[model samples]
Target: MTGKLDAAFGFHETALRLRSERQGVLASNIANADTPNYKARDFDFARALQQATGSADPAAAAATPAPALARTAPAHIATGAAGTLVAGNAPLLYRTGTQGGVDGNSVDMEVERNAFTDNAVRYEASVTLINTQIKNMLTAIQG
Candidate 1:
């Protein structure tokens, strides 16, 4: 039962976490907008979410000779491939500057603000879905 719940909620939980992480990066970019030589950092949410959900690398999986063994730990999800990128550790890509700045700060206020707002909406959606799932589970167990 616990494992089932974990599997069901895993994607949402990971999404919430990754969204928060991305928000932090965006916020950092906003906060340092005036700082000289500050480079804006961000990641691809789609790739991060796919990785978090233990999405198989189709190419790698197809070429594999044998299936991966199940992991023993509850938190040890995924044997996707030799180099599966984790959500928590997704590589950060520097945001390209739209206009030349004398201070060399790549933190664009408009871009960071837009990204932050988008992330916040997605984060809220993920939280709402998680809550709904929990409520449904509780109703099932109680009745």
Candidate 2:
């Protein structure tokens, strides 16, 4: 029962964390939109989520060759190439701009904003699902 509960919530928990991390990455791009030579970086959310949930594609992971960081202590800061990856410490990829900036800044406000907003919605959904799962587990235990 304990194992099943853990397995059930694992994907949602990882998704929540990854989505939160992606939000920050997108926000950073938006924040640095004006900074010269600020190359925008982001990861494929679907790929990241798949990796975090231990559903990574071996071919993809092998091609990328991610460097992972393990947090053994509670006080250890999260690895921020996007918060120390879970299934693998996949590196962030640079975003290609539709309209290049004169100053070599890669961030496009519209794209960044859209991605940020979309990630927020997905994050909230993951949180809601997790909460529902917890509630169901509690009810089952109580019964």
Model 2: C-alpha RMSD to truth? 5.3
Residue clash pairs of candidate 2: none
TM-score of 1: 0.76
Using lDDT, give the best candidate's number: 2
Candidate with best TM-score: 2
Give candidate 2's whole-model lDDT.
0.80
lDDT of 2 by residue, 1-143 (tens): 77986788777777787787888889989989999999998887888777766788889777876666777899998775545353335567889999898999989898999999988988888788888878997898899
Q: Report the CA-based lDDT of candidate 1 relative to the real structure.
A: 0.77
Local distance difference test values of all predictions, in order = 0.77, 0.80
- TM-scores for every predicted model: 0.76, 0.78
Looking at model 2, residue 66 earns an lDDT score of: 62
Q: How would you encode candidate 1's per-residue C-alpha lDDT over 17-131 as one tens digit per residue?
A: 8998888889989999999999888887886676567684758535633333566788986666323333643456788888857999988788889889988998988888888
Off by over 4 Å in 2: 67-88
